[model samples]
Target: MYRFLFAIDKEISYSDLKTLLKKGSGIVVDVRSKDEVDKGRISGSIHIPVENVESDMSLDSAEFKSKFGVAKPSLDSSELIFHCQLGRRGAAATEKARSLGFKNSRNYAGGYKEWSEKEGK
Candidate 1:
């Protein structure tokens, strides 16, 4: 039942993600590595870096707990949209998010390259 409902291995359109972001709720995470983030990211994305996500600690563990100061749902386990260069990492992140119980996670296939182009940056 959960698998059917929260399947994370799904691709969402770039326009859909952009609309969600403009609507002003939920989280947008960048599952890319730190070096990738250093190259510039979507202005408001939380950089969890995919490596931390694969650890036994999970993205919701002590490290982020201290950062958020609350036992809230981790970005990986929350309603979110993820993106990375070309979208592969975003797809991986969606699967991880579903494994962690996020029913509304999705991968933005167009990624940062698309975003930068749209924004003329």
Candidate 2:
């Protein structure tokens, strides 16, 4: 079941994400490429570039886990939060996830830039 404390919308805020992570109530997906990711990313978030969201999310649980180091989130999960350098790719990935049946997948619209500046990354 969706345990999010805030509105279950298409986007999530940094403050809400912090609470989500603290609660272990969701998964944060970084949809940026290797070069972008090498700069920085949210701790504990899984990396699956925007170009690969469909193929990777389509993998079975075991394969997905082996590939991404995290369990494949069920299609019904509302906690698959996507993010990118400045939100564009994250929004795209979120749409891709939604198209794949992740009904309530959300994007972290603030992206890494906002996050890094806030966290001093």
Among these predictions, the greatest TM-score belongs to 2
How many clashes does each candidate structure show, in the order listed? 0, 0
Clashes of 2: 0
Note the Cα lDDT for every prediction shown.
0.69, 0.91
lDDT of 1 by residue, 69-104 (tens): 434455455346778888888888777867776656
Q: Give the TM-score of candidate 2.
A: 0.91
- TM-score for all predictions? 0.73, 0.91
Q: Residue 11: error of model 1 in Å?
A: 2.3
User: What is the lDDT for 60 in model 1?
Assistant: 50
Q: Which model scores highest in lDDT? A: 2
Model 1, residue 36: C-alpha shift (Å): 1.8
Clashing pairs in 1: none
